[model samples]
Target: MSDIEIIKAKRAGFCFGVKRAVNITFKAAKKGKGVFTLGPLIHNPQVIEKLCKEGVCPTENTEDRNIQTLIIRTHGIPLELYQTFLKKDFKVIDATCPFVKKAQQYAKLLCDEGYQVIILGDEKHPEVKSLMSYAGKDAIILDSNQELQKIKNKKRVGVVVQTTQPTNLLQEFIGKLVSRVSELKVFNTICNSTALRLKETKEIARRVDLMIVAGGKNSANTTQLATLCNASSVKTYHIETSSEIKKEWIKDVARVGITAGASTPEWIISEIESRIRDIGGNGDNGYPHESGRN
Candidate 1:
């Protein structure tokens, strides 16, 4: 049997917010309600597909009039759409993560206080878009320190961040804005789960020769995890499922580290582990050790 050791990151599965959102959606589906989500509940496709089969339809927009029950994604939605849903009298259930909701509230607080609100994240991201809406249409979305040049000598600036954004980026952005803006209010709204995942994955990357990050390809957090690992000294591969684990990638790899995005389900992690064991060129007992977490 080939000798292989696998290390699984403890934080490598669904975070609290995603678990809460999935539970809420499944519960609604079991009640036989016409359950619907404004967008995919979470980034993981497998989870979304499973929910779709359970009759939780994902709508591109809020135009559907017959939707009996609507669930807001964990990423939250625009304030305007939320009001529209209320006006239409649709039974709305908000699944927005507490951290995301806090950011939204912070944005609104800044706007009401007449501060120049600046969102530190990708403008196209739904979370940023929603947060910006709360801040006001005039609020600026700043993606980088370079973008800060666009700010025209504001008196007071209030800043909020996307929940999934890297904490270092936020600190750096604030550092630059500190000198430019006379009065600055910086709110660090990154989720705890996200911070933990990054820390754990980086630790694992240092210990293992090969690192495999598991989750949906389009998932921003997942992509970030993979990017972090890839930039490190270890060889890292980002895969959505076990089937993508190539024999060549694992060839001659004695130690492998596995980390999944927050949205990944437990079953997917297990499948990836099992596949790694099989692809390590040993069916019997290649997996000598697995530590860190489930």
Candidate 2:
């Protein structure tokens, strides 16, 4: 064994949606006005700290009329909350990801078309909740296939998903749903960026001795990446920063693959790669060189 090697996913880190949200938030922060987000913009503490330095803060309650500017996060908020901000006459800067917007739009359309909209994702997730608002009170949130048995009104069913949900889980949910429904329409609202990252991570995990999945601890997409890597039955570690990587975890490993969540920045990924190289003698593990690897 020569050293650790990183097999980074081509589509990993700051997808178009996340990048747009971050850029909008940073630009608003630069205005140096009283700007507040409904929640942390993107879940990365480092990025949130940087925003805080620029006068962007997060508030849990939009009911407080003192705030001048209310910025929606990437995951978005329920429609009712957005309406509340409008009623309060706050300057609303919508930084919601376009992909997330599509999901919400699909949910609303399904409801308008008289189908019972079913969201395949965590019920508590802000994105799913936001979709529910558009779907009306009749919308159902399904987190797992087991919950499919409880669904009623199988004649007209429409399905959408949280942007960060695993593709396999979404597909499985859809598969189980079709069996129970006479009419099923699926929008496939899972973000393309997330699907691509998951596919790449699985492929890399299969060929590496160990894998490092880096992102914010609370980020749903990041957690999903770690879950996918672990499902490959490889030695996988999920860490937010380079400091969290343990030398013992990869001490006996030859090739190490590294991947980051969609919310992660390139600098964070580079930092982890540098730390891994410091532990091993070299970075490629003496494997045959492939053009444009990593």
Candidate 3:
């Protein structure tokens, strides 16, 4: 067999939202005061650990009266929580990604205009829950096409999605609702960064012998990328760090592809590439410098 080669997605890792969130958190930490994120600033543990070293930490609840500065993550919190912080006089640094902010705005707008807002995402995800609060008590969360059947009246339905959700899932939910609803308005709120990553990952997966999805396990976008890759019927592995890589997995593979979620850092990707090269005896494959096209 020929020597192993590595192919990587150009758009993978640290999209605008994650970058902004990390930057804001680090800046706050630099002030050398107590800084608390309403949740983990982003999904990558390595990044979180780095932030912890800088004096930024995640609190389980947002009602931390002890912390003077509250940093919202890229996935914006519920409107009620934002109000609560304001009421408590906590100095708030909103690190919510612009893409997620847009989704919240669109959901709120639809609900205010008397349309029944339908969120297409995981009902329990922090971002989706936050968006639901913006949509008011009447909003519905549709996780699958079957859930759409339960929606009543179906007229004046407004559609929005979690930024990390696959575009096809959102489209499938909307397509199902369009037939049942008399009036449907879709905001297409899925982040372009996410869409691009998914597209590029899927493309790379098609040409590789195995796909390694690098990111924190808890990261929604990272898991979604792995799911997309596995759907291609290729061997796929999701790893949080380079140490997790197993030599046995790549024994027979001659070509491997690497991709990361929006929250993944460039260093982690580089580390994974290095490990793969050492184990598989392949050159760098000129990732990040290459066009990233398969």
The regions of model 3 sitting more than 4 angstroms off are: 1-4, 61-66, 251-253, 282-294
lDDT of 2 by residue, 8-114 (tens): 77776888978888888888877758888887888788778778888887888877766888899888888988887787767899988988999999999999999
Span of 10 residues, lowest total lDDT, candidate 2: 281-290
Candidate 3 residue-wise lDDT, 1-294, digit = tens: 225689988987899888888888888888758788876888889998988888888887656666878898887888887887887756889998898899999999999988988898888888898899999777888888888776775778888888777778877777777889899888989877878888899999999999999999988789999999999999999999989987777765678999999899999999998888767533233222223432
Could you say which candidate leads in lDDT?
A: 1
**Residue-by-residue lDDT tens digits, candidate 1, 1-294:** 344689999999899988999999999999876789888888889999999999998997667776889999888988988888887756889999888999999999989988888999898988898998899756999888889888864788889988887788988888888988789988888877888899999999999989999999989889999999988878988888898988878876778999999899999999988888777733334434445421
Model 1 / residue 208 / CA error / Å: 1.4
Cα RMSD, each candidate = 3.9, 4.5, 5.2
Of candidates 3 and 1, the better by TM-score: 1
Arranged by lDDT, best first = 1, 3, 2
